[model samples]
Target: MFNLRTRDQIRRVETGKSTSNTTNGNGSTSQFGFSSMDGERQPLLGHQATTTLHAEPGFWRHLLFSAKSSPGTNSPNPFVRWPAQVWNVTKITLFSSWINLLLVFVPLGIVAGELKWGAPWVFTLNFFAIIPLAAVLSFATEEIAGRLGETLGGLVNATFGNAVELIVSIVALRAGEIEVVQSSMIGSILSNLLLVLGMCFFLGGIYNMRGQDGHGHEQSFSTATAQTTCSLMTLASASMILPAALYGVLSQAEEDNKQASILVLSRGTSIILLFLYCLYLYFALRTHQKLFEPEVSQVSDSDTGEEEHEPLLGPWAAALVLVVTTLVISVCADHMVDSIDALVATGKISKTFIGLILIPIVGNAAEHVTACVVAIKDKMDLAMGVAIGSSIQIALLVTPALVMLGWAIGQPMTLHFETFETVAFALSVLVVTYTVQDGKSNYLEGAMLLGLYIIIALAFWVSPTGALGKV
Candidate 1:
């Protein structure tokens, strides 16, 4: 939850001034301790008020679980309810209404596509409808992640949060839409690495600037995130570069042999990537756990006299939400795919445009919003984890799973991407790896990333007819 501390409290947190209890009107006093760099506590006489910064009508209670007061309430606010802070703002404003409004198109797409109303309308509606459902999936993943600790939470967020992209690829693969599957996966990697991470840093920097001005405090960057992201990105870059290089060389001779070689290489690479992903999970969840932990604060609950735990949306409920949302996304994705054939027949949009730009964007709408919102709320760890983690999942988990699944279905998806896309993929990973190396972020970095994405998008959008090449 968002918190607003009195100037005195802010000063104490900054200066490590001691705090003492002051008698209330009821003759009760509370003790507060402030720690200095030398690990000594000092006591001063008085009370400093803390305020919860925001709240919604009814849902705030459940989300906050342990919060004592809502925004503007006269009662003392104990803990900053992070879930409430993040959820309420997103729900009351853009995410909530945007999701609801877009949902109306769900039936529109179904009806239009099923009834053959027209390819353009059906395709547009299906695309729009997935945006909200993706948001819902993202929310469920975050809620579930909240129950798990950061390491596992991040893994969960990355894996299931990206189920939309996974399902889309699988469905497209089955339908023999190889171009859509490959481009969408590639686009997913680039967008999450560039666009999502960029926005998080940009928004987080502004919030950090404000916090520094008022309280002289900023959320620390996670070194573990930096190391893990760099390693995984390096892996992604190598995976992409190898295939691109191999195809460029080996694919120049016999057409049939080229296809077989590409398929063989893709299958082998998929197994290796999947193994690496499992190893990453093991390292994160089993060994070296402390590296990813959120910094601990020594705030004790005044009433309960215990540490405050993360308020969670119970595991069962979270799982149910995830399951339901994923089902909806799958249904909507099927509808979306149904329109693809017709839309391609009209000669209006290319598969590259839909895969590289439109599909990835809609597929990631929720995660994009959640990551930026969390960053703004000063949860940079979660935000960075979601952004980089999603890209890793796409590269290591989803892409490989799709390739194997394609092989099973006799569609035989390959990592043999267009030359430009392969270059773009490698460059995107390198740029992000470089940016996160210092474990810090700022608005300028975000702007640079967003600029790159725009340039990449335009490159795909403006390609001449048949220039993207057949998959």
Candidate 2:
């Protein structure tokens, strides 16, 4: 009799027709529908209607059970739901790319470090480990940024996209590897400006040409935005040149306190650059935001059917993943830094080559791939932002931050790069300036950038470590 009564009540609630009324202990009459034990009204079980629930869930419940479960499944144990949601998010994040197969290296890296493995083993394992970790970091950062809307999202992306470089640099700086810190900083800038941007132009040109009914096609981005970014790069180049010039002039004069003078100058300049970065952010995000807004281009008929994927994780889950990934990256970076001396002592590679070429490649690999993929889709503005904007952050933000960090830590990290590196950086910026000056890109321009990068890499590979000392 009780079971039959419950069935009739559920049917009435499902139909959204509560015919019965109940008298509460306080003499208040209430409609007999779905209600919690606390007398709060619940939504009809089968009524296909939109309703807003004002209940606030607990923090742990919100975090763990944010993702909806699959349809038609019976309610499992409460303990199983959180883990299942986590597993779903993890699977989506890690298995999205074949590169994540390298994640096996993360644990291998830790094991190698703990087992007292040789420097080669540890370095190799940790180096590869950072690659997938970088990819995951990029993914999680985008997921979180997506929820923040465009203006704040761009800021979040700029800060966290370079988190790996920042982490590795901090580790090296703390270890007194000033050269490693400086080289990695410039390397990241070069890789983004030349290698990543070059690939974007090249692939974008090729893809557009194939998609369109033309032989000599060109991909174009916003000229004003490109000019603004290039001007900043020019300023960064000037910053590099001025310090090296000061060092040179002082050394030529036989000044007794040259290093001390340069140290003070570098610290002051870093603070100024950081200020300039803040201004740039304000200009881009607040005052003149429309200038940086992405320009829409006509999509080709072949591309119109493609769908964008929604973020796999909620903001909280993404933030959690980001924190976890960063911690893992720090562990891997520490292991890698510990092995650098041994790796260099083998005579097979120099510290300069490792810092300038190899380390930046690891740090910027995911970003490089992302820029090229977007460029191929003809989203030149976004591609340019990823490529050139990243370089700007490294130059105007990360480099300055490292100098400040070094000051606090008693290391002499400075803007004074080697003469050759400064020259390469200047020339690379010049080439990019010219390439983007007209707001048009073609395969030839891209080929030129890649050619120049290859030349620079070869020169570094042959140059001995410490041979090109700071000016």
Candidate 3:
């Protein structure tokens, strides 16, 4: 079903550019566009030379559909992305996003039901062990998505990830415990950085090395300047946490409330950092549009169009289920935290250690898998960007969100990071940044990243005060 020529054409359309086919040779002039006269613009000139900037492979799908269907008043993402709105016309997207909502809440409902018996074990079971189950399911969604396409795969991944984050954040708010929530968050970060990134690097390197070509494509570093800059900023923000924490500690004698103030300063740091990172993303995406060179497959012509139809579900029926599901899922996220925390306590392991290493990795497992797959497809830029870009989000955006949320609940937690955590984050960013700066990576670099990640893990294990102690 996947024709080589058609797939090649689809790639071209996806990248959104064309070679200079402005003038054809005399023999191929008709192929370019039929001419009406010997010395005149071709009859099809309007069609052939139309240069569009945002032409993804699905450009025609949306265009053709929009041409036939009237745009409803409720529509937001119109024109080129009208296909995405296709779900609005049917039940698929609404159903998927809403189903994701319920998945987050179901576990919490079970816990509330158990509260009727006033059973402590039930409460503990729900708190410590059950949350990881949801995380595993959430991870499964990503795993399945890898085999699927964007319409289904990507939609599922983004919606579910956001849904879980939205729901759990609220629960953690009410539990009134910074120790538990922050620890889990740290876990998510580790899952993404060391485990997720390391797997991708290993797979991509091995795949490329095994190919007939001597080395997979050697990346040119100039192409990834924007991403590199963001990574460095992540390092900078992370590094500042060390001094900030130490400042609070050292200043505690002069100001007994310095601990409280550290949280304030840390949150402030996150706000400033997110603003800068957003700017970086905007410019990087823009530059990618202008300067990125497409692979050969992206240059060919192909017919990826197909017959379309209305979907299986009705409008309001879809809406109700989605809304209910989302609420349920949100409830479950809080329940998840309880279970995960209980597990940590029962085992007598360091809560902060688990979080710093596990939570982020689990949270971003899907994105990590996608990056590895993208690299195999030879989209090196997108692959590298995914790991580094997402890291920036966790370090800057996610960290800050936790602090602000703490404030909203009348618990003022500072944005100041622990000394060891700050140093580990800084070292990780710097080593990875320098290696990737040249825009070329080999198995060796991937191995080095993994090795550093191991050392980071070992340090976390040995340090009793999280990152505060020398490993």
- What candidate 3 gets wrong by more than 4 Å, as runs, is 1-167, 184-187, 210-222, 225-232, 235-249, 252-255, 284-325, 462-471
The parts of candidate 1 lying over 4 Å away from their true place are 1-98, 141-158, 210-220, 297-320
Q: Write the per-residue lDDT of candidate 3 for residues 29-83, one digit (tens) a residue.
A: 2212112223342211111221232455544543333221111212333452334
Question: How do the residues 1-471 of candidate 1 rate in per-residue lDDT, one tens digit apiece?
Answer: 001111112212222323243232223443222221122311110112123343334334423432221232212432343443333333322232246568777788778767877778878888888887776666556556655665666567557767888878877888898888988999998888889989988877777764535754444568776777678878877877787677668745797887788889989999999998888877766586566553343121343233322212334545766787677777778878878877877777777878988888898886677678767756566677667877878888888888899888899788877777888888887788788877777777888898899999989878743687633
Report the lDDT of model 2 for residue 281. Answer: 84
**Inter-residue clash pairs, candidate 2:** none
State TM-scores per candidate: 0.73, 0.82, 0.60
Candidate 2 per-residue lDDT, tens place, 59-143, comes to 2342233232221111244354445445556765775456788999999999998887999999999999999999889778776
Please, what is the whole-model Cα lDDT of each candidate in the order they appear? Answer: 0.66, 0.75, 0.47
User: Which candidate has the highest TM-score of all?
Assistant: 2
TM-score of 3: 0.60
- Which structure is stronger by lDDT: 1 or 3? 1
- Deviation in angstroms for 280 in model 2? 1.0
| Model 1 RMSD vs true structure | 11.0
| RMSD value for candidate 2 | 12.7
